[model samples]
Target chain A: MRHLLPRARRGPAFRAAALALALAAVPAAAQEGFGFGEPEAEAAAALPSAGPASGASVGGELSFSIDAFYRAEDEVADLPFEGLAEGVLEFKASGTKVEAFIKLKLSENILGESPEDMLDEAYLRLYLGPHSLEGGLLKLVWGKADSQGPLDVLNPFDLRDLRITETLERKIAEPMLHATFALGDFTKLELAFLPGFEGHRIAAEGPWAPAQVEALELLGIDFEGYLPDTEGLEYAQAGLRFTTSSGPVDWGLQYFYGRLPTPAVVFIPPVSLSLSYDPYHQLGLDAAAVFAGFNLRAEAAANLTEDLEGDDPEVYNPSLLWSLGFDRDLFGGINLNLQGSGSFRLAEEGVGEVAYDIEADTERTRTRVTAILSQKLRNETIEWELRALYGIEDADFYLLPRLAFDVGDAEIEIGAGIFGGDEEGELGQFAESSWARLLLSYEF
Target chain B: MKRLALLAAVLAAGAASLGAQGALGAEEIVRASRDRIQADTVSSRSRMMIVAKDGSATERLVDQYSLDAKEGKRTVIVFQKPASVAGTRFLTVSNPGRDDDRWIFLPSLAKVRRIAGSEGSGSFVGTDFSYDDISSSDREVEEDTHAILREEKLEGKDCWVIESRPKDPSFQYTRMVHWIEKGSCIALKAELYDKKGLLKLLEFSQFKEVQGRITPMATKLSNLQANTSTSIAVEILKYDEKIPAGVFTPRYLETGRPQ
Candidate 1:
């Protein structure tokens, strides 16, 4: 079924003159295949050198990027220049009932710290009738919302580069075992277990460094010394999710038990700082549906932390988090996506004693709105996009405008990120770090 | 065969003296043209070339699998070349009286996303063909009103010039004019008109027999307004293959496995 445009809504003419076309419908008896000459013959010869195999393939990509700060010098001087080179290799092999994939990445930051090489994901899947099992270091997304949804908390984030937002670029894969039981055509039950904990990574001494560190040091406190060890068995996590469809809406319910990915800071009575990871139980519900032409998604979660009664000074209080979003094409092929997310603490009486580097996490109630406007031109060979994030409570905002050109297997992207508003707010904390970047990549 | 009935009808009613019989003959001819090829499942690998107005060109490699299902027709298309889109897959399932259900899987996302059926007007992977054009082959003959415009020789063959106006007023095309070869009952050329007049010209060629079924192995669509065109030529094709039912599911779209 094709998605045909309503006749009355047809856009204006593509151009002026209507040229007569020469139809090439040669008689079958005389010509071999409606012979349209060499063009068609050339395309037929462009096929792969090798024929189809038993589904085993290897491919990779190589990329390089450079960032140039353009903010005022008076503001905290941002990094003069930052460059990165990355290479990725993927191997995939499949069988009738089993499949395996390995993705290896080698990333080198020329202007930063140590270069690292690692396996991004190496997983094996076993198909058993209507159920399947997967294991290895894996990365998974768990929410319906396109943006920051509370239910998508399965993996820790890589916050070292605050300018990145795409989940694929910002997520940190972890070791896990996952299983899915197909209950019906549109229903499934999933179980996931992570044997260890990996917290979000934040830069220690860069333009993107946490603002809380500076604030604590100004008060004569050594912030890093108080960080608690998180390598113990108690930090493991597990979750279960059930997804099904009702009418036109797809919905899911999930429950997870794990330690918070971000640590909470509290002040001790005797002039000391306490930083620790608190265990929590999260119950979430998510749904996605299309109404009219809009794709709508929503997610809500209640996180019950150790400070349920609001009596623990070093633990976080329980909170309710929610996100709602929708995406639709406005007109003339331009698309718009908007999302709003909020977190409301159930009992905030005990959390005021400490300050959070991330302003949204410290408030009793915090709300933020994100929007993305994008357009594709030249039959999708070129794309222009603008993304914005606003902190409703802190009066802070961040804007990112990008343009990309796709040339066969290569792509070139140019973009800039700007931050403004309350300097202490989550996004505004990097107000002086605004910069423009150029990225180029090619895949094979 | 349907082609024989079309020929018989046209011969019984003298071409120049026919009126209402001409319209019925047109519909029968169009139906016969579409029903000429029948298969339980069809699989093919093709190479497509997009030529720009400036004469520059790019190519893509693709694999397509199609089968008839209880719900309707089901298809899966996978991109193999042009690394930027490699590993991407799309699934579409026809739903009789309702809009088709569609989904896409982008390797970067590692998840499946449902696509709104209203995006039919959009280009297919930046090519000259629109999403609607991908499924046009399955459009029912009854969806449009047909009439024989005239009979003429097209490159040495006596062909019927037929005009078809969509029954749905909201269809993208205002009308489509076809040049069908008489003996084979195969549409060799089609002129698709938008509100502004001639919009795109489509030609089918490379007729071949696969598993006792006649099939068109090449297609070219040219956008007159933009002076650009895309040509797809089948490198390999097979009919009536046994494709597992699981290959059409969302799970298969995501995992690339027929589980």
Candidate 2:
């Protein structure tokens, strides 16, 4: 589902035409598959705080980082060059039945004089008897899927990001109050209340926007604006999750009552020219287990949107989405991960009735597969990885081979990506957008 | 085993008798070494340094917590540093008859995944020590056949050299030889061998007394075949310390805080 932009809330200070972008790079990229190599202790240990000589724990850590990258890609692919300097201050206090944590981020862009994003996360957590309460901003990750999963629905993704340049950890945190009650030894019941909501960040115009727009034209619909706001507490998004572990298997059942993070167009045309985060309900089941040598994981979600019957093409439609994957070590140091994910329209009405060739549309999903193979070498100081994402039905694919070296307190990464197959397919749209990039980051 | 015990008493009183040492069977000596360092809980923060053949080194900060349970010992290791390995946690719970239940939590994926087998023989987080090496003390004596090699004096301390061969063919090491200090019963050194021959050399030093318990502050593992080694020095250590039991679960893996 996709939607239109609401009356523009973006101020003139957005520097919309700046030739540079505010890089959203997250340091979590190099920390793949449990991570390798060693880190210095002097600069890494959490800030010291004296406990009862032994009882209650209270301490905090402050860290600063500088990141710079040089890219050789075309104008529409993304910003040509970007650099950011940021500092993270985190404080943690744990005592009795209470454990609190908060992180404040301060950043400034080297190129773009645009505004800097601040206040990364702040949360206060209390443990009362068998229940827990947490409130403030948080990046809550869910589901068992490896890289991507339709069942991982709690947080909204940063759509303005460029791959490799920004890690998936760039996901925006939501203002939420979450609670969990222990039901048994390996089970817990979770409830969350999200007060503020935002739809997916859709880039106004870029090389990637063409295919999406073209697909709409084929459906005899005109793309317009997008609206991302929802009312306060009374209409707040809410969710419930039941999680349990049995022997070697871990599983969870989830239910969410909220607006779809993505949008459905207001194809009811005459009245409004905007897109919105339509109301929806979802039921999801996810599980993970390691048998033989493979670490198996799977997730499935069935969503009920505004157009449950699929009679309206302009509204969001009901759909079933799922993902299955496994990870295992091969040879001595090579690690392999493979995943298969897919989504299906619940009914054949409306746009589902329109038949377009594989190359004509990228959003028309049937099946997609992703694979990641990484090898640790040079006494685990050097890492080499090859990642692939393919649209099986559309015959479109993207490949990226990257290398990273651990030098002192910093990591140097270099990589190149290539896109091929049907030009209208998701990955294939970047067929001519291929480019190489170099990134250097140091933490202290 | 009785004859060996008698001989061991004889050696303790007067000499170095290899034949008498054999009388005490390897299993009894191993049991003493394993049970000597008794404690309800253990907590420590260590700095690990890995040195390659070229003398280049990489360092890591690690915190380990272990508690003795009814079944066996439960251990957890967390890496906090360099941004690359930060927020990574590995948990291993020992079982009486089974190998172990192992799991790892990586912040990147933000999930706790199981490590299928202890026999995989892969290095523990790129270190020279194998995954099983971290829990070798918890391995049951019945899982292997033991025999005393001899009594030797090295580093000016009397030592009983015992050899243990795994009864299960699928085990990672074919055989292992340990140097158990005569009176203290602490393993000062160990040699591991596979089908190809000697694989690793482990040495423990910097013994210190904490909470009335003798603890080793330094340990080094040398990968003989690769000419690489890793040394871990405990910066802070506490024995019989109180650690919340909740830290053993995945919840602590994400929060780094014990309930």
TM-score of each: 0.85, 0.80
Scored against the true structure, residue B224 in model 1 reaches a CA lDDT of 96
User: Global CA lDDT of candidate 1, please?
Assistant: 0.71
Clashes of each: 1, 9
Q: Cα miss at A193, model 1 (Å)? A: 0.8
Q: Which candidate is the best by lDDT?
A: 1
TM-score of model 2 relative to the true fold? 0.80
Question: Which DockQ-derived CAPRI band holds candidate 2?
Answer: acceptable
Positional deviation of residue B85's Cα in model 1 after best superposition, in angstroms: 1.4
lDDT of 1 by residue, B88-107 (tens): 88877766776556667898
For model 1 chain A, the run of ten residues with the poorest summed lDDT: A15-24
Q: How big is the positional error of residue B84 in model 2, measured in Å on the Cα after superposition? A: 3.1
